[model samples]
Target: MQYSPDSDPSYDLKIHAGFKVVRDYSFSFDKVEISFKDMVRFIFPSTGYLIFNLFFGDDFTLRFLNYDLSEDLPHHLYITGLLSRGMLITGQQGTGGGYAMKIHPVIGYHFLRIPMYQLTDRQVRLSHIFDREGRPLRQLEANASARTLNDPGVKGFFSKYLPDKSVYLRDPVYHAVNKIISKKGIIQVKKLATECCMSERTLHRQFLLKVGLSPQSYAKIWQLHFTMELLKNNPGAKLQGIAFKAGYYDVAHLARDFREKLFVPPSQFYRDVNPMMQSYLDFPDSLQ
Candidate 1:
């Protein structure tokens, strides 16, 4: 199906990665996008489009083929879980103004409960990629998708639970801190406290009450998350170069961190873990 941005009143005002991807039918079968981290996604409700999940986000989808989003008007969203991988296999569309956030699955789930914070990111297995259920979970393939906004199967899932104004009580703290992490990879706790205009103890408290993981842990996660991204883009980059770019002091430090998070060293093989190069080949302009 074709997708254009939603112009209605209820949709999330933010856009994400606005770009056009042209598919050459004779030269190629399909163009695919794959990402491991969280990313902002949008679809125009006026146009019927199925937003397919490419990686770690769509663990609980029920249906895989012939899904519809035209009826999903009020723009429902949720803080999605950490997807092992992510992919989008479908027709062309336009979207903009969003990026991948650093929040972990545990912390992200809490954000879903907030009303004003519609985790617009969704997980859906594409029919073309995986036949039946999209990906396997707990030994078997998972068979669920975020129910359509107006779908009878799960109507009002977001409305019935999330708050009306803002779902997060610590919105200011989380927003400011996360913004810093986005730009700086790793940040000191004391510096984070000052940046948010809150005390050190208060920052820790807010993190605990709202998000289960501590701030330091979250930063480390984002650090490695960024590392994975850097490795993906600069495939020829050596360990030290990748380390410095991703905010590490040396190659050993980078290797240790990679092992701690992904259970493998940087030299082992990241491409085998995920098809990073092929995904980039799909969007040459963006990579350039």
Candidate 2:
């Protein structure tokens, strides 16, 4: 599951009692959904990409981007910027069929050309930034509903939007980010700055510019991510063992970190929902 810059993610399909998560890497698409459940809340961490959601049904009302409970965004395509952390709560889910595309971190900046740090933990209409004309995801969503679009069509859609790689795309900061992700956020921030031959302040600036989070913040989130992965894959593993393996000093240390980041203990966090979907969608093994 090692991912090079060009590597597409591996896929996995998970079937819950009522909802199914199609973890397809076919079009750089992370997950597809056709929900039959009433409500599901998704807790997602930073994935360094702007997420495109081509929502097809009107039954589900998702409250994110600080939308009020009365707001209903139906039959529209939504775009979420690089999130530091966020929650998606679906109200009255019946048929929320959709396609999700993970826009490359660099390409997001290239297209928007704005400070990504400002976009952290927010959502906007994709049409608002790129506009409705020549909207690829909207077209794909239509075709998908009609059973006219295949995997190749999805691939072609993204190929059209791939950004030209500038020096920043291949810079040391980019490499350092990948290295930290590869090690499951276990690597030291000081070591990463040294390897990139930049001062710690410079490293932080680059990360905020490119990935919308400081390296320290991303690393902490990734540690929680790794812990979740371990829990999902090895349900029988002891809490103490999982914590230590995920780079926490002990179970208490892990608990405190989880409380600060997730606002819940690990056990309570995993009790209500399937962690697998979030894990696969957010921190796929290829990127890890």
Candidate 3:
């Protein structure tokens, strides 16, 4: 069934279905809970973030790159790394719920202590990553309820893993990432390299090592994200205007990017995809 953002009860029901913000860390992460029934969501590519998912109900399936890869996630905790392409998720009818933590990629890299490139477009069980330490996290997940999910107990559990403040301030890639975001991905790689005081080649290498995606790829993702935000905020705005604002040379360029990355033209995406599904694109205020 098609869901319309307005004048449709099913759309409202699906969009509102048990979605809640458990907590907002402002600086580093967000804790949220989601429950849904027979939902299919298309998750667009991200600028860069690691998503920690804790599932508590029926299984859901994730398909990437037009089903070239598919995985079933049962009731358990999993973490997904930065995705350079869109993903499709399907949850069958009947209620299912989960908790998610969206973390900054730099912090994710420090926590995982591995080259970020290895995790690009991948999801692994939390237990697999943490080994013995994962037991306590599982226990906490088992004990959590909607009301108590955001308690200090859980917050404290994760606090120990928070990277040092200096780590963020000292990282050149982090600064470059922020500059890319601040400009809404309008800056070119050469200009970004110059501003960051590094050669284009060095910047590209560092960005891949640190964020799992090259600077140009990351910028494109952010550019798409920026376009999505504009579409969401101004549904009545013209595509041509939106394209230029999002750094595309013309509407055709914007449409080409959307077709290549999202598998749909911008017009179809704006018309068919519910705004609620794109809510994840809203970065935390701290990031802005």
Task: Report the lDDT tens digits of candidate 2 across residue range 7-41.
Answer: 23232233222221223322344434545444444
Per-residue lDDT over 235-269 for candidate 1, one digit per residue giving the tens place of the 0 to 100 score: 88877888888888898988876655555677653
Question: By lDDT, who's the top model here?
Answer: 3
**lDDT of candidate 1 at residue 249, scale 0 to 100:** 88
Give the runs in model 3 whose Cα sits over 4 Å from its true position.
1-47, 58-75, 138-148, 151-156, 283-288
Clashes of each: 22, 0, 0
RMSD after CA superposition, every candidate? 15.3, 8.7, 4.9
TM-score of each: 0.47, 0.70, 0.76
Compared with the true structure, the alpha-carbon lDDT of candidate 1 equals 0.38
**lDDT score, candidate 1, position 219:** 63
Pairwise TM-score winner, candidates 1 and 3: 3
State the lDDT at 223 in candidate 1: 74
Ranking of models by TM-score = 3, 2, 1
The C-alpha stretches of model 2 lying farther than 4 A from their native spots are 1-26, 30-49, 58-60, 65-75, 85-88, 92-94, 131-157, 165-169, 275-288
